[model samples]
Target: MKKRLIYGWLLAGVTFASSCTKNFDEVNTDPYKATSENFNPNFLMSQAQIQFSQTGYDQLLFQSMWVQSLASTFDYYANGDKYVLRGSGTGYYSRTWNRGYGALTLVDEMKNLVQGKTQYSNLDACGTILRVMFIQRITDLHGDVPYSQEGQAKSGNVAPVFDKQQDIYKAMLSQLDAATAALDLNKDKPSSDLFYGGDISKWKRLGYSLMLKAAMRLTKVDAATAKTYAEKAYAAGTMTSVADNAKVLTDNANGNSNSNSDALLVADDFREVRWGKTLIDIMKTSNDPRISAVAEVSAGTGKAANEDRATPGVNTASLQIGMPNGYDLNGGATDISKAPNYPGTSPANPAVPNDAPAPVGKYSRPRLTVYDDRSGVNMLYTYGESELLLAEAAVRGWNTGSAATHYANALAADIRSLAQMNATPQAVVSDNDIASYVSRNPLNTANTTALQQINTEYYVVTSTTFNFNETFANWRRSGYPVLTPVTYPGQYITGSIPRRMPYPITLPQTNGANYQAAVANQGPDNFATRVWWDKQ
Candidate 1:
């Protein structure tokens, strides 16, 4: 009876195995997962674009306030406003590093998908330009970063050594030169491009424009290299007009909302964050038309109403008062109430029940219609920025162009660029108004302050467009606008503004040897240390 039972079980097992083996490949394959062979590589371009463009709290928590473009009294923003650690401060420090690398990884994969394919030459070249762009930003933010072995984890390079910033810049310029030259307008364009909708001509412009910016960054440390690349970029053709600006409009319906808009719409942030006095004062001093286009005073009274994102604010340029940085609503000595030129608290709202006065209600905030639009455009690189860089290059005796002409072009281009920020065109400065404003603010190349004037306008243009990273970087490099370091009691760094952001706090543990080596060479893994280009 035992032998009969064993024979029966063996027969049943054989029958089951034979049945399962009939469709083994079909059963194991995942239909939902896209393979390289099946997936369209163009889709990754959109992901890369959105990911890099959506900086969110990464820039806001540090560069924005550190550069004094926007100021916030909220605890989280103390990371920048007061140079003190607050909620998720460590996490915020890692944000750019993590996000930037993540974006680079996507671009790397996208490139690999079409690396040797002749039909996808444009995609490959565009990916190369994007790779250079991301590497430039990463090295700029942190002194040394993984470049040669970056995004090679799948190929057994789990621990990539950090490359020196100087080497990285050299490599970036070389890569940009080849990539921009490789861009053939006849080739197939990236169908999923977020900027310019797959226009190869515009991509060519963006590539050269980015090259110009990267080259200009080396002015302080490597003027010869700067001049070489700047002239090359100018000859290759940088952005010539606002139409060549590289910007991406967020699609809220598709769950790709503008990160800045989302961050600003947070009630606490929307309530307390205001235009910095340094920024507003400069605009007001220059009689800048952007003052009215960018800033607004809260409409209703009390904290409840002031925090309301639905209601529009008063955008009269004269009434828009900027709040000073390093001050808060903590009811301490550094409270907003104790601030100089304090506009006083907003009147209590009768509609609300026992609401407190908004500490920053009277201070200028970013206009809701302009800044809080979920579907707003993210201005990446602009024609204005390119022209400004060329203007500086010309001033330094580089064979770029006339300094006065480039500077004036930048001024006009920047004003026109504002209208592109909103989805429905909120900050519309008319051509007549833009031309009039540009005429009034001439770039006197003869003055000793030529460089200062050019860069200060660069500061204002970048700050108003909410590109705080560039604003901070340019401020450090050019030393324009002359921001006073915030001397809050428990600040992290003293005596000067942060030259570079600290590496991710988790770096030492995750990549110990590489992280230590970087610190050893780059100095201390702190904010006070300068990158290669930010020369003393």
Candidate 2:
């Protein structure tokens, strides 16, 4: 189904290639003409939307969380088998550049295409919202980033100045507000909205929901402003069910089949990760129906995670002894296979050996089981995320909605989302599983414990995504889903858990004065110090 594109914008000197045209002067020839119309704008939009989760972007943010470095790397796992995120020693400077800043390449495209287009206002609005989301995520993870000048690289921004994280947020929030306000269900549908397929109402809902998320980011430093913005976002409608969950429709390369979320989840990071004890305990405690879906229980994981499994703190388990970050440095079928935790050293399809393998998925990093399907498109935003935002808002009395109900809804959405994987080979968890969790946990809606549960859920669900940008965000804000310090065989640095990733090595030369100023304001150029948000 390859569609022809608009060829009116091609350059004068460029030679055009085409099967349909008779001659060069006969047909149109624009550079992005084919890219613009043939691309199924929906697909293009989705590509931008999922940029943060894409291969082009995964290694930095996603890999960071998978490895659980406050600022650096260690190994990883769903079962918490070893220690540190994969490929340690050097912090992921390039990885961050791609996943975070690199993501802007696509997101900015969406922004530029939307400018001044009244006909595609809905699409434009949607693009703007997503663009802001990606931007905020980037700055949040990497402190200051080049915002205004980023993407203009060809026009002389080869080395853009880094904007402060605080300033970046301010700009992002402004954009989000504009996007939200611009959302009009009455506006013409793009007929190409891949996320919701021309559903303006859905787009509107997502915009508001994203607003809540952005606003929530300010909670630590500016609670009053956070609450004000939170209220505004809630006043706008939000997702009410799982059907409204927003994710791209990802397909395999030969592009024939649709894989499961876990395919992507357990794909590469699978090599890098095992599991952490804290996550194991949480799943086991609630008799968590999703445990089996997310992780393979270690020989003693069930017993180890369950002191009193019915308990809320029942724990995701403890001290998983996560794998070292670069455990598979040798990079071979044999290296990835003999993880010590994996049951068989040899896989069924060796060509596609060691997880998704080369020809299969082409994923460079390891993955967790939760993202089982690499084929599923990037999850731009979801109802589950919206509800959690609402729950947090309600907790703060920022809005009038029932926070408890939203909290429960948030948990329920993930459970249902993971229901299949959650069920064991022996038996599927039914109403009994849900009831047991709710009763024992006793979500008072008013309790920090309830909030913590949801926050923890947010971290796990987020941690299981493509690369772990959001997972780190939650960790900084709430301090839940506790992870132990990584004791790398390298320099100890007192084995102190890292609090912030150091500014990239290039920053000193690139934006020396501003970078120095930020460091001074932030106090302690060392990674051990917390960010502005981590008061606790």
- The number of the candidate with the highest TM-score is 1
Clashes of 2: 72
Instruction: Give the alpha carbon lDDT tens digit for every residue of 1-536 in model 1.
Output: 99999999999989987998989888789998899788999999989988988888989889999999999888889999999988878788888888889999999999999967898899999999889877777788888999999999989999999998888998898998998899898888889998888999998989999989998998888899999999998998999899998888998999998899899999899998899999999999988888889999888889888988999999998998888899887898999899998888898888789888877899999999999999998888899999999999999889998999999999999988999997788998778878888899898786458998899999998998988888988898898989999988888898878899999988889899999999998888889999889969
lDDT of each: 0.90, 0.55
Question: What is the Cα-based lDDT of residue 446 in candidate 2?
Answer: 53
TM-score for each of the candidates:
0.95, 0.70
lDDT: worst 10-residue window of model 2: 358-367
Candidate 2 has an lDDT of 0.55
CA RMSD per model (angstroms): 3.0, 10.5
Model 1: residue 222 alpha-carbon error in angstroms: 0.6
